[model samples]
Target: MPTKTLRIPTTDGPADAFAAFPDDGKRHPGVLMYSDAFGRRPVLERMATELAGHGYYVLLPNLYHRHGPAPVTELPEYIGEEVRPAVLARLMPVLEAHTADRVLSDADAYLGFLTAQPEVCAGPVAVTGYCIGTLYALNTAAARPDAVAAVAGFHPGFVVTDAPDSPHRLIPGLAAEVHLGIAEGDVTPEIIGELTRALDAVGLGHTCEVYPGTVHGFTMADTDAFSAAGLKIHWDRLLSLLDRALARD
Candidate 1:
């Protein structure tokens, strides 16, 4: 696989991103990969490379570009109890600033850039995200039903929030396969049930599962809650969803 650093022109500003794809010189399906609130870092780069190894052209953008370029703030090598609060303090404002409107705008630019790449095949693409990135992933899929074929969100925060513009509210617009991996400790059973009901109401093909005993950020190798077993489960579900959504084309 080969990886490259790239920039995308967005309505708000130029967004920095990373791309990884197979070296075969053959065009592959495009996939928009969103990074967690921690922003783009080594872990995200590794994940993008891993996805590209599966034969898709993976694009990982710096979602917090509105505030600053990635590594927006220095992330600790490891996110333990003592360092978690400080990191969140610096990250909260950027996360809050990523309103639905901003996400939709970036989505347009991102999807456009990905599809235009020489290594990407034509047709609908897929979107996948982790943690806070999951909200944007869901919104992007809904906003571009014609171009996004599937969406997968893992350990997402604010999925069941009371906010008027919560990502779950856009489910009706999604014309894609959806998969959600909820951390057991992130939300109550009732919340998950309500989200599932919303998905059903929209007639979207989807699956929602709770990864047992895992807390938020279970798939992030740098987090204290990281679970190797749970991460494996997440990868299995994500790759399966991508294969069904992008591989066919």
Candidate 2:
């Protein structure tokens, strides 16, 4: 795999990002990966490289570039239970300030830069995210269905919120196949039904199920809630969705 640091032009400013791709000199399907509220770090970089090894061009960007590059705030190498509260306390204001407008602006810039990469093939791309990035991934897919062929989220957050602009409410605009791997107790049954109904309303092929015996943020290795089994399932679901949607070789 080959990886490179990048600067992506956006409405707010140049976002610091990274790209991971196979070193085969062949253009591959593009995948726009959104990081969780934790943002970019070594864990995410390794994940991107692993995905790129499967024959796709993966672009991971710093969502809070307006404030600064990733680690917009200092972060612990491991976000364990003891330090989780402090991290969230420091990050809450910054996370809240990232409005939907900013999300859309960054999405456009990310997709534009991703599809234009020399290593990326010309076609609708797939978007995948973890935790809060699920919201970003869903928004990007809905806002540009013609350009997003698949959208998958794991241990997702804020997808079934009461807000009018909730991820579920954006289902009508999606033309892509969807898959959401939920964490146990993270989402209630009633909310799951609501999300299912919303996706059903649009006749979209989708899956929204709780991965067994896992807690929120199960897919993130550095978190206290990390579950190796859950992470394996996440990769299975994600790769299947991307392969079916993007037709990568």
Judged by TM-score, which candidate is best? Answer: 2
Instruction: Please name the candidate that would achieve the greatest lDDT relative to the true structure.
Output: 2
Over 197-242, each residue of candidate 2 has an lDDT whose tens digit, in order, gives 9999999999998999999999889888999999999999999898
Off by over 4 Å in 2: none
**Clash pairs, model 1 backbone:** none
Write one digit per residue (lDDT tens) for candidate 1, span 139-216: 998889999999999998888778878888888889999999989878788888888999899888799999988989
TM-score of each: 0.96, 0.98
TM-score of 1: 0.96
In order, how many clashes per candidate? 0, 0
Candidate 1 residue spans exceeding 4 A from truth: none
